[model samples]
Target chain A: MTVQATLKAPGEKLIRIRLELEAHEVREAAISGDFFIHPEESVSILEEALLGRPGTQEKLLKRLQDTVELGGLELVGISAESIASCALKAYENRKGPGKA
Target chain B: MEEWRLIIDRPGRGTYNMAVDLSILNSLARQACPPTLRLYSWYPPAITIGYFQRLEEEVRINKCRAAGVDVIRRVTGGGAVFHDRELTYSVFIPLSHSLALPSIRESYGLLCSPIVECLKSYGLNAHFSPVNDVLTGGAKLSGSAQTRRNGVLLQHGTLLVGADTELMFSLLNVSKEKSVAAAEGSPEGRVTSLSALLGELVLDGEFQTDLSMRLANAFAEGLGCVFVQAELSEAERREALEIEEGLFKREEWNRDRSIRPAFGAAGD
Candidate 1:
């Protein structure tokens, strides 16, 4: 089953995450939010970067950091750390049955 | 005291207004000009989306076009703003300027202090609300956005003088929560204009000129700058026109390249 989690942080901005975790690989991730970023197009690039990456804390953080560094994305109210945490939080909160 | 060029521009088309701000910012970046502040208005009124905001999501395009309201994109990051019934100002300065703090948030607080003082001068109890807005009577009176490039920073803001709240909200794609709040009371109802506060709409010409002079004086005192009135130079005008015709007026720069804005729970 696809898992979805929505998190609102710092009061004003909200980020919702939906993805599938298969054999330790994050797949089909879709992240959307109401936040401002300089070079606004960078969000699409960040969304694309999350695909097929490991959903673990270290891997997620590295992925997010790398995305910002590569794209020079400046998130005004949202942080990559928040995004990473949401991913992990959603994964843990997944409604699907655990793999055998 | 530092010398700052001050331009009290005639009302202009939205495209030209944005282009002029960018032109001055670029000139400052190149050290081709000194720091400056421009106070201006929109002709035909406009809705400008933040750099990261989606065009279709932020505005009601057909409604905007039908009303002849031009919709443009800003280089600065902020929520969508309806630019009618407002006094707009843009300040351009080098990043190394004492007022331009290295931290964006700190810079916003320091820069917005002048605007707060401007409102306070009018006998309104105004104060900075942090991150980039000025509030009066516990509601927002002005909001500013910032963008930095090439060692220069440009901060632009809109100060509400009056508005057609119904028309303004009709032009925006307000979120469900804000919509609900609006049903009870317009989410934007929190936004109060000087005219609204004063109980009658002031004559546009008189109000504009008066507000401009007061803000100019407040800014001069706050920033320790001597305001020298000046018009746009040939080079700056040429650049602004180029941007006006080529970029701000183009779909690729204005519409097709926008991101959707997220909605909050009647806030932000």
Candidate 2:
């Protein structure tokens, strides 16, 4: 099932996350926002990196952090933690056969 | 005094305008051109969403099409902007320049100083707000966006001469409550135009020319540089055309924000 969550983290631009979750795993993910990220293409890379990752906060946050570090991405008004939190929020909001 | 190119462009289509800016940035990055300041307007009027924004979430495409308005995506990241009844200015500088500070907030403040000065000349008490906004009396009068790549910085912003809040709201994805508020005068009661502030219509060739000159002078004084009026070189024009065709005009780039050209993407 697909779920979406929007966040306006303090001192950051609005971030909207959409995730397709199945069995508590992220099957697909798309992130969009007004936040600034250097090497802007890294945004697409980060989105692509989310696929098949376990939709837990810790796993998602670790994956995002590793991706940012590996890519040397500079986020001006957003952060990996914020994005991971947003993705987790989407997962928590998911509606599916097994999900509450 | 240091010298810069001052390009006063005639109103052009959205794609062409964006193409010219990117072309200039690319040239400067390659050390093929001097620093530049370009002042321009939109032909059909347009909406430019920031790089990170999703078009489907930010703009009402069918509404814009019916109104003969163009929708383009900017290389810089920021909130979406409506380019109607506004003069847009862009400045390109190498990172080694004194004005291009290492800190993003500091750089924005320095680059926006000219805009604040220009508004102050018209008797408005304007000030630069952090991250890329110019404000007067707590209402936003101008907003800017920036991108740095290959040790070059390009910052562009808009100065509103007039506004059609209802039309703007129709083209953007905003709530009915905000649209109604905008109809009363300004968008969300937070935007004010030069015409509204000056208590007269500021739309005319003479006024535009005067405003452009004033902005150029302000930039020259603020940056400690002199500007020589010039047209885009043949090479730059050709590059702009290339970008217009290869990047700006492409559906994959504009609507989907995919398929970026090497020179068009932003990075440190």
Q: In the order shown, what is each candidate's alpha-carbon RMSD?
A: 6.9, 3.7
Mind giving the per-residue lDDT tens digits that candidate 2 earns over A9-91?
65566788888878877778888877788777778888877777545788878888899999988787788988988877777
User: DockQ of candidate 2?
Assistant: 0.45
Tens digits of lDDT, candidate 1, A1-100: 4665656555345566777667656667766545566555567777666677545788888888899988877776678888888777777665455321
User: In order, what lDDT does every prediction score?
Assistant: 0.76, 0.84
Q: A86, model 2: CA deviation in Å?
A: 1.6
Q: Model 1: per-residue lDDT, tens digit, B86-181? A: 889999888898888877877788788888888887788888876667877766778899877667788999999888889998898775544454
Judging by TM-score against the true structure, name the best candidate.
Answer: 2
Candidate 2 residues lying further than 4 Å off, grouped into runs, are A53-59, A96-100, B175-189, B201-205, B264-268
Largest lDDT belongs to which candidate?
2
Best of the candidates, DockQ: 2
Please write out the lDDT profile of model 2 over residues B139-196, one tens digit for every residue: 8899988888777899999999889999998888853434455576542337888988
Model 1 pairs whose backbones collide = A34-B262, B54-B259
Interface RMSD computed for candidate 2 is what? 2.6
Q: What value does the lDDT take at residue B139 in candidate 1? A: 67
